[model samples]
Target: MCGIVTAIATNNVVPVLLEGLRKLEYRGYDSAGLAVLAGELTRLRSCGRVAELAALADARQLSAHIGIAHTRWATHGVPSERNAHPHISGGLAVVHNGIIENFESIKADLQGKGYVFESETDTEAIAHLVHYKLQANTDLFEAVRQATNELVGAYAIGVVAEADPFRVIVARRGSPLLLGIGEDGMYAASDTAALLQVTRKIVYLEDGDLAELRRDSYIVIRSDGSPVEREVHISSLSADAVELGKFRHYMQKEIFEQPQALAQTLELIAGGAGITPQHFGARAGEVFDGVRRVLVLACGTSYHAGLVARYWIESIAKLPVTVEIASEYRYRESVPDPDTLVVVISQSGETADTLAALKHAKALGMQRTLAICNVPESAIVRETALRFITRAGPEIGVASTKAFTTQLAAFALLTLALAKINGRLSAEDEERRLAALRHLPVAVQKVLELEPEIEQWAQRFAGKEHALFLGRGSHWPIAMEGALKLKEISYIHAEAYAAGELKHGPLALVDKDMPVIAVSPADELLEKLKSNLQEVRARGGELYVFADAGSEIPESEGVHILHMPEHYGMLSPVLHVIPLQLLSYHAALVKGTDVDKPRNLAKSVTVE
Candidate 1:
C-alpha cells in the first residue's frame, strides 16, 4: 500500500502536502518524496519517513502552488532515493499507488522510443507513457487519460506537467482516489484522513474516471471521453480522531481505545434494544430470507474475523458457513450457489484481494452479497447491496486492535439477526443477548485494566525468538490472532494451534526456550484445555496463560497465570484478544522495534 496527496492551491502548498503525507503515514511506507511545479518540475526525495522528506524540503526551501507527494511502500523496486515516487520524465512528474502489471512491455516500448528511465519502478513506465502522450496533445488531462488506456493493472495516479503548472491530473482504475473540494483550491488523495484538514467535502472517483484539478474548479471525465458528474459528499472523519493523544504510539493508543470503539460500534444495540435483520441494511431482510448457506471471504486479520464468524453462524443460525482466504479464493474454482449469502469483511473496505474475490463470487451468480466494513464511502461498500459500517474510528496502527474487536462485535450482531430471522432465537434469549452486548464496553474497560500485568508478562518475551499460542473452540481464532499480533509487531516467530493438536506435531517443538501462551476461558472446552497445558508442562515448556476468573490453573514453576477480570461467556473472544494485543505492544516496546510502522507491512493492502 502507498499514499498519494496532490494539491493545486492558490497559496504555497508545501505545508499542506507534508501534512497530508503525515496523515497518510499510518498506511505504511519506506520512502517519501514530492514534486512541486515551481515554474519547472522540481522534486525532492528521501529514503526514510515523511519527517526526513519534510526536513529535506525545509533545507532546500521547496515551495509551490501546485504539487504531488507520495509515501512509497516499494512494490516494484528497492527502498531508495531513486526508487521513491514523484518519478519524472520529460516535463511530466507522476506519483502512483497500486501496480502496473504490464510494465515490462511498456518499458521496453518506451525505451525503444528513446525514453530514458531513472528509477526501476512500474510507476516510471507511467511517467514515460504520459510524457509520450503529451507529445501528441498538450492537454494534461487528455494525455493522462490516453496513457492510462494502455495500462493493464490497478492504479491511482497524480500527474503534473510543467507545461500545465496550474493543473493536476488524477485518475483511478482499481485503487482508491478521491477529490477534495477546498475553499481555495482542489485536492486529491488516497484516503479521507489525508484531506480532513483542508476540506470535508469529497468526491469519490470510480474506476476508469479521470479528473483535472485547478485552483478554483475541477472537471471529471469517463473512460469513453464523455463528461460525467460525480456527487460531492461530506466526509465524516475528524482530524482529532487520528491524533495520538497521551499515548506513546498509535498502536498503544488504538489498543486502549477499544472500549470506546466497541461502545460506538454497538451504539445501536447497546441501549438494550432488540436486534433485527434491518441492523445491517435496509435490504437485509430480503437477502437473509433466501440465503441457505454463508460464504465469508477476507484477507489477513479480516480473514481471521471470518473464521470466528463461521463458528457463530453455524451454531447459532444453523446455517453451514465457509470461510475462504480472499486472495486464494479469487484464483481457484469454487462452487457458488444463488441462495448463498457472501459476506466480505474488511476494515478499510478497499482491500484489493477481498474486493476482487467479491467480484469473482458475483460473477459466479452469488448475487446476494453483504460487506462488513468501516469506511462508508469505500468501493467494497458501494459494490455490495448491503453493508454494516463498523465505527472503530481511524485505525492508524499497522497492527490492528480496535478494528478487529469491532469487526467481531459486528459479526455477533449479524449472527443474532440471522438467528432471529430464522425463528431460532426466542424473545427472552434475544433480550439476554442484547443486554450482554450492551455490557461489552464496560467489560472491555475492565480488560484494559490488566495492561500493567500484561506488561510484566511481556518483559519475559523481550528476548524470545519464538512463541506458541493455544486455544480451544472459538478461542482457537483468538489464539491465531494473538500469534499474528506478536509476529507482526515484535518480529517474533509465532504460531497458533487448537489445543487438541499439540500431541500430533507441535508438542515436539515445545521446550523451555519456547513460551506457550494459552487462552484459558471458562467455556465447555476448559477441562480439555487444562489437559493440554499439562502436556506442555510435561515437555518442559514454559506457560503464559490468560485464564478466566477463578480458574483452577495454579501459578507454579513454569506456569504463569494472569486471570482475566471477568468471564464474558459468548463474547469472551473480544475480551481475550485485548491482553494479547497489549502483550505484543509492550514486547515490541521492550525490543525497541518500530511499533506503529512494522517492517515489510502496510496498514491497508491496496495492491495484490
Candidate 2:
C-alpha cells in the first residue's frame, strides 16, 4: 500500500497537496516525492518520511498550480531516492501504488525499444510507456489509457504532463483512488481522509476506471474512453476521527476507545438495524450443520483473532476448526471440499493475501464463505456470500487495537449463533452466553481502566529490547497478538510462547533485561500460567502480568500485576487484550517511534 494525491487548480495548490499527503501518510512512509508543473519541469523527492520531502520541496520553492505527490512503501525496489515515486519520462511524470505483476516483461520490452530507465521500479516503466505513446498520440488521457492496457496486475496511477500543465489523469485497477471536486480545484487521493479538508463530496474510482480532472471540470470514463456516470458519495468521518485528542499517539487513543468501539459493535449487531448474526443465524446453522469441517483464513492481527475463534468454534459450537495464515493457505495445493465452510476475517476487508485465499477457496467449489470485516463496503465484503461488519470506526493507527477486540466479539457471537443452530447448546445456554456477551463492553471498560498501571509498568520495561509474552489456552493467541503489536510499533523483539513450551526452546532468550508479559487471566489454565510465571521469575525474567482481581499473585517475588475484572471464560480474551494493547502503545511512545505510521508498513495491502 502507498499514498497518492493529485491536485489541479487555477491558484496555488502545493499547500493543499501537502495537507492531503499528511493525511494519507498512514498508508506509507518508506519514501516520499512530488512532481509539479510550474511552467517548467520540477521534481522533489526523498528517501524518508513525508516531512523530509516537504522540507526538501520547501527549499527548492517547488510550488505549482497542478501536482501529484506520493508516499511510497517500497515493493519493487529498495527504499532510496532513485527508487522513489513520481518517476518522470520526457515531459510526463507518474506516481503509482500496487504491484505491476508483468513489470519485468514490460521493462525488458521497453528497454529493447531504446527507452532509458532511471530507477528499478515498475512505475518507471509506466512513465516510459506513456512517454512513448504520447509521441504518436498527443492526448494525455489516450496515452495513459493505451499505456495501462499493456500493463497487467494491480495499480492506482496518477499522472501529470508538462504539455498539458492544467490537467491530471488518474486510473485504478485493484487499488483505491478517490476524487474530490472543489470550487477552485479538484483533488484525487487514495482515501477520504486525505481530501476531507478540501471537500466532503467524493467519488471512488472502480477497477478499470479512468478520470480526467482539470481546474474547472472533472470527468469519469471507462478504459475504452467512453464517458460514464460517477456517484459522488459523502463521507461520514469527522475531523476528530484523525485527531489524537488528549492521547499522545493514535495507537493509544484507539486503545482507550476500545470500550466504546466494542460497545458500538455490540449495539450494531444486537440492535438489528443492519446485518447481524440474527439475520444469518438460521442460514449459518443450515450451512454448518451439514458441514464436516471449517476453515478460517486471515492475516496479521486478524489471524490471531481466528486462533481465538478456533477455541470458540471447537468448545462452544462443537465443530472441528482449522486456522490458516492467508498468505500460505493459497500457495499450498490443499483445497477444501464443498462441504467445508470458509471464514475470512479482515479489518480493511482488502488485505491482498486474504482476498487471494477467498478466491482460491471459491475456485475450489467451496460454496459457503463468510466475511467478517470492519469496512462494510470493502472488496472482500462484496465477494463473500455472507458478511458481518465490525463497527470499529476508522482505525487510523497502522497497528490494530479495536479491530482485534471487535473481531473476537464477532467470532464469539458467530460461535454462539452456530451453537444455537447446530443444537449443540440449549436455549438456556445460548441465553447465558448472550448475557455474558452483553456485559463484555463493561468488562472491557474495566480492563481499560488499568492503563495507568500498565503505562507505569511500561516505563520500567522501555529500555529492554526484547520481551516474552506467555499464556495458555485461549489466552495463548492473545499473548501472540500482544507480542506482535509490541514488535510492530515499538521495535521491540518480542515472542509469544505457550506456557508449557517456554522451557522447550524460547526460554533461552530470557535474561535479566528480558521482561515477560504474561496473560494470566482467571481461567481454567490460571494455575498453570501462574506456575509458568514463577518459572520465568526464577530465571531473573521480569514478570509483568494481567491477572484477575482475586487471583493470588506471589508478593514474595517481583510480581507486577495489573488486575482485570473477572469475566466469563471466552470473553476474557477480549478484555485481557486491552491492557496489553495499552502497554505496547505506551512502550512505543516511550521509544519515540512513529506509532501511527510504523516503518515499512502501510494501512492496507491492496496489491499482491
Q: Compare the candidates by TM-score and give the number of the best one.
A: 1
lDDT of 2: 0.85
Residue range 62-87, candidate 2, lDDT tens digits: 77899999988888889999999899
Point to the candidate with the largest lDDT.
1
Give candidate 2 regions above 4 Å deviation. Answer: 59-63, 224-230, 269-291
- Candidate 2, residue 170: how far the Cα is off, in Å: 1.3
| lDDT agreement with native, every candidate | 0.93, 0.85
lDDT of 1: 0.93
TM-score of each: 0.99, 0.93
